[model samples]
Target: MKKLSFLFIIFILIHSSVSAIDRRTEQFSTEFGYLTLPLPYVIPGAGMGLGFLGGFNNVPFGST
Candidate 1:
C-alpha cells in the first residue's frame, strides 16, 4: 500500500510539466508543508493513523 502511494507520487513528479500563462508560476511551485495530510490508505498495515496526523503540523520555515 505504502509502496503504491510512493510510486504514484513519483510518477506524478516525473510526468509533471510546468506551463506558465502570465509569468506567475511561483504560485504553482510544489510545496511539502502539508501535502501529506490527505493520504488514504487502502491497505492498512500498521500505525496509519499516527502517520496522517503527523503531517498536519509540520509547517516548514519557508512554506508558501
Candidate 2:
C-alpha cells in the first residue's frame, strides 16, 4: 500500500507538472440531492451520497 501510494504521488507530481491548470474553480462542496417524490425505484428521504467533486487533484503548476 505504501509503495502504491508513493508511486501514485510521483505519477500525480509528474502529470501535474507536465500539464497546466486554470485557476477558476467552485469553492463550495455542494450536497447532491435527488427528488424522489413518489418514485418506485427510490425510497423517500434516502440520500444517495455527497457530490464530492474532489479538488485535491486540482493543483496548479506552481503548487507541484
RMSD of 1: 21.0
Q: Which model scores highest in lDDT?
A: 2
Model 1 clashing-pair count: 0
For candidate 1, the lDDT comes to 0.59
Candidate 2, residue 57: how far the Cα is off, in Å: 43
- Provide TM-scores for the models: 0.26, 0.30
Residues 1-64, candidate 1: write the lDDT tens digits: 9999999998888776544347655744455555345455554565443335444344456735
lDDT of 2 by residue, 11-52 (tens): 999999999677686765344444433333444698454343
- The segments of candidate 1 whose C-alpha lies over 4 angstroms from its true place after superposition are 17-64
User: Per-residue lDDT for 12 in model 1?
Assistant: 82
Let me know the TM-score candidate 1 reaches against the reference structure.
Answer: 0.26
Question: What global local distance difference test value does model 2 have?
Answer: 0.60
